[model samples]
Target: MRRWFMHLGALVLAGGAAAQSPLAEFDPADFGKVVIQPRQSTSGAGGIAFEQAFGNYQNEPVIAYGEGSQAVRLGRPVGRLDMLFEDGSTGFCTAFIVDDTHLLTNYHCIPGLPRDGVQPQVKAAQFVAGYIRPGHGEGVDRYTVAPNAVEADRALDYAVLEVFGDPSQTYGRLELAGVDPEDGEFLWIIGHPQGQSQHISREGCAASSPAVSGEGKLMHTCDTLGGNSGSPVLRLSDKRVVALHHAGDSRTGYNMAIPMARILAVSKFLKGAEGLPAAAPAPLPEVPAGACDALWAEAKGQGCAGYGAYLASCGTHAFAGLARNLQASDCGTAAPAVIHGALTVKPSGGDFPTLAEAVQRAPYGARVSVWPGVYSGPVYVTKDIEITGAGPRDQIVIDGVMHWSRGRGAVRGLTLRQGVAVDGGSLTLEDNVITSPATGIALRGGDAVVRANLVQQTGEAGVSISSNGAVRVEANRITRSAHAGIEIRDGAAPEVFDNEISDGAQSGVYLHSGGGGVLRGNEIHHNAFHAISAKGAVKPVVRGNRLHSNGYDAVRLREGAGGTWEDNDLSGNRAGGFRVEPDAGNVLLRGNRE
Candidate 1:
């Protein structure tokens, strides 16, 4: 996600210089990678276990219908990543050649951003191509990663790194598809799962429908594990790279990948195939009131006498009716009175009977206000609009899922039952009460402002930010979560501050799996676990927070996790204050007392 902690001025840590030193000798057994457990799914539609399909490569079982000859050669460019962190730890991921010099992988695979005075955790890394089987390293081409030659976007969860040598000349790089994969289209993944030999997951793997896929991400039923983080998802029909496989969720019974198109749109080091569709033009900036007269004169010069004529001539213009609306108005006191489209949803005698109907019928930039009543949902928002509950939050409730994908909007003053899921775009979730069997507010691949809300008793986290979600959680009270009060993982780095979080079954604030962010000025206590817990390459900035009376240590850092912890009050914790595991990396502790 977005880098929230910028100036980490003069970090002070114990054994910091030693942790930053290069390893004198490399030992495979000493450094270890995080092993992500495979989430089990009872649904037959879920991914087939890796053991069942490609476990015995000698006699690969036919896992899907219409068994045919497989294109095993497509795995040529795929490779396993071996990384050595500065902390003397190691990890492995998957990567593939995208061009002659550059390779594509997950940002989390090399989750290091050397900024200001901080250094990247990865001291050195290499890519091993053509490692087809365990103990079969002969003939495999190894290339070192070019120093500081990495371009990554945490929000997109993709990285492009230059290799020291042109290994693609031998293996050949893969071309990215210009478009997203069609729903239900079969896809293939070639990678090193669990750091094993190169294996292709093709049988029964297909893209999920758009309704289920969300935005900016392609959900698929592909068998993958921790080491498969950066695998390229290839379209079975054209054999073109369509997405970059990233994380898997057992709760959803699908694995998630970053769409190649989304990555190409913002990438500076990579380009899409020829004939890639052009992006939509950005909306024009708002016109100033002082320019109204000049604009009106220009319109009149074009043979447009009135506002109606000007609108007819330039209906697509951003200021189509601005001049006419402000002709006789003072710029300061009598500004243009602009009217926006508005719709109402009520139990009866309103523009629409259901919130879903109003949202579907409302045009972009419209307002949909809900009256006092419980509304049944599964409301899918796909346009830019504001949805506000006109009555009290509890009086106007949404009793099911509210899914917002590829839309920018605000949802305010409502009591939500099954919770809200934001997949992409920017959304403001404010002044609402949310309760759910799962996460009260789940964000993936989007920017959201979650402020001044009450989220309680979620079966999962009260607020779960994952898969590169950029969120600002402020002034919220979260309690009684079955999991963490706020769970951040899979490269999400949210800015969380000024919140009251308590009574979580897990940590009040839990971060792991390349997650980092700034947690400041929060009141966190009475959790079953630590008040704040971080692990697995995370580096959150925890400062100015009152943390007390937790079941375990107030703060715990393990598994190469390190960050700046400053001026936090750590008192009355059952297991003492700060506990850093032996394998923990460089943690900066300044002005903190137990």
Candidate 2:
């Protein structure tokens, strides 16, 4: 016989009252919204419109779980996980304790499993339990997740990790249900929605009959958002975990989750009836001395005729080890014809026909040389590799976006037509000519070195850095940008020095939205707007630059902007040298000659 929680309706009414109550220091902007793409309707008949489906949505604060109720007790194991990536960006997700030393979360939240010598992108991760609201909670405690002790499956969209401090001993863990939830069974979800205080979706949450989708995901109607990716879906009847919420489609009025039973079927952590022991870590493979010499001899013996086949026979791990050995050995010199250990890409009749093929086949930390030809666009680089063009920049072109997402690498002596975007890694982009329909270079969450490049005629700013992005912009020629020559926003602080910035439709350099950086020894002139414009909580250090011959003022600081300006040559402008608005926060002007 199944037992259900009584007074469910009363609990929901109490939840509404709690949600309406205001809390201190609750800033909506601090929470990052998870953007979910609209999925095609599974039902041939178009589902109810999004407006109608969510018109009476019933998601309540976790406090609504009620005092001394089973809902509150079961929610004790849920927590908010904060992740710091290798690129210096931070993100948050939801997770729950499964065992004394283990926690469970979505695979997408922690994609880097520690097997096969692959390092995870997440540099650090911590879980905070009882985070009921901003600055408010009940017995809140924080624990760190061990980076090396992670078991994950991308296909299943789940990860089981060992928490270093064994947090479950204090909060207890949720028990997985032996059977799947029945059709139309009432369920409830508890998680941090949009990185806010924990919330519960229970009023109208229910499991659909025949809930399993083609991908083995359970379809349900639960109010969820971006940070709710790893929330536990519990059966109201028994308070046992039944599913792991992963995604939602507002258009179809349905959310998807991985059934707990399905995850248990393949979980190595938990074993049959009597739980089995966790597997021990595997030993590292040994690379014998002269391994690189032997591999190079084999490739040369084949006359490089079957280089692709040879790479496959060597295997990714083996070749990666060999590449390391070669880098450390004396045979690492660049040969005039066919450099040893470096893959060559040409338009035709080379080691690889395309740059993409060469990059994909190259082992970790390998070098790829492109020989004076027009390669295609949208080349995605995920590892550390140096790609250099053989001839002049204009002769070697990549017609689309060069997206760098992980590791550290460099691209030199090439002409990039569309532009470059770095979101999750460090890239050194140097000695290149770049032009684009949009911003010539966009940096969101990574570090980049933009040096010795010619950037011109972009649809937007010549270079843009935003949202925790760190870049060193130096020794570049920037001109004819549709907007500012360099635009910085959203908490980004970069170093700008020794560049020629001119002929922009807007300011030569614009800083706003809490952007700040050091601008030194640059020539800024001939812009449609001010030479430099700072606004809205920005505090940049402007020093030793020749800000003259512009259409507007040399510097304009307004709307609470504050910065240090010293030793700048401000003359020959259409407007005055400096315009500091009364509302500006603070300005330090010294030795600036007009």
Candidate 3:
């Protein structure tokens, strides 16, 4: 006999300080209307009589399923989520499966969402498998849920669980909708409403709206009660889950659900999920262009302050992406972005009238959105701020250095004509293209991470580091440099990995002045000098590199430099493989393939 399985998570009213209270409000009446219900039940009897109170009415049909019923196939995925908390109070909600082993429910049904996607609450709870009617003539088949299989997001009021076995192979799994159901589409909600056995609200349930006050949410007329908190809102046309019912308004009989689109965006547990439906059309919000020229120099900042308001004005639709990212970081409460967290800047006309003003006016750690156009001035980054291009990386060009100071921040998707120079502080640069006549990145500072970038035609080195902080240079391509592709000195420890260095006028990399770190997974070729040159007290750990067709020696460890080189492809060099000077001490070079 096939059994419909459900692996549920835990739920509780979490404390406020650690997890920010959700700005989005949900009426608790919709979560579970029945109170103090038993954790276990076998008979399909109503836990208690539906009381006649407070002028309540029901236009929806609570249809019970039997053999040859219309809802038998549709109700298979809908199973009971029996949760027993540490306080010894047992609560049961509804959950459904999206895959062979994964189930979706409400975050309030499982309070503590693991940042690491491991569900520890599953072990502390039980699941009443196949608890619905038509299949419940025998006895309740209880399944013990394993630990670390639940993932929850309290803000969205949703939780996903991984079952121990392949249940999708038996009862089958429901699909998730990327778009909402068209108007008048029939909807079905199956759950143990009012703590009763699972029943289907086959009629008087459909998607309606004036969103229950947030982005990517649907207002549905699903007759739900307490235990229905995690029930799936299914679109009858295709039978895909459109949303997860969370709360309802008792005064209006309107219920709200978290849209599946938002769930697909925010849930880390669904990363790289295949066999899912296609994504619906999601357009980026439009941003206006600007001039950061003489007209705005007099004003400290013009129109720039209004950009934040404009971005915020796009409503919940523009905020879905931000909400997804925040939920992944376990911060669902901070949804519906506050403009106070970000700032807007323009090139020469729109906001601030210049890139310089955006830098000067933006608060520390604030995200600055710079519109497209050639901003012909150096941006002095004095504070820890993140500056992003409103358009493509090539569309937003800064003809001067994005000079860094004692600030720590990130710079992404910007084209720096003169390149970047960070003198101090912790800085991370990613996906940036630097076309400089001098140096692409002159990092005299500490704690820098330069990754997935392109550096071209440097008058000096492609990258220069002279600090003591832990720096990481990963997945970067340095080409056509007038000097070395990379230089590290002054006792700096920089880990350079998975970089492509070629066509440089000098060595591919240089380490001097006691500098030391790791250089691995790099493609070093066609340089004018040695592929790598280490001197002084520098002793780096080098491994897993391809050094080929260099104009000079593959590696030169001279003047007291010692190195551990292993697992490298050393071939096609014009000169010798490596040179270890008499005073450079014995270097370890092993596992190299000629």
Segments in model 3 whose C-alpha atoms lie over 4 Å from true places: 1-339
Better of 1 and 3 by lDDT: 1
Q: Candidate 2: how many backbone clashes? A: 0
For residue 81, model 2's alpha carbon misses the true position, in angstroms, by 70
| Worst-scoring 10-residue span by lDDT in model 1 | 5-14
Please provide, for model 1 over 1-594, each residue's C-alpha lDDT reduced to its tens digit, 9 standing for 90 to 100. Answer: 222221111111122121121111224443322222222211221232111122322322122121122343456678877777676545557889987789898776676434444665777778887676455556677888853447889788788888868877566577788688887888888887656667677766888886136456788877765467788988854467888987654446677888888888888888876433222223334555556555556765653244444443333355643543443232322112232445667766567878888878775556777766778968988766789875446667788889988556799988899999999767899999999999999988677999999999999999988847568999999999999999888988899999999999989988988888899999999999999998899989899999998999999999999999999999999999999999998999999989
Q: What does candidate 3 score on TM?
A: 0.45
Give lDDT tens digits, candidate 3, residues 428-546: 89988898988899988756899999998899999998877768999999999998999988988889999999999999999999888899999999999989988888889999999
RMSD of 2: 22.7
Ranking by lDDT: 1, 2, 3
lDDT tens per residue, model 2, 325-425 = 34323344221121224566766545676877777666555677775567895788876678887544566789978888865678998889999888866
| Evaluation by TM-score, superior candidate among 2 and 3 | 3
Assess candidate 3 and give its lDDT. 0.65
How good is model 2 by TM-score? Answer: 0.45
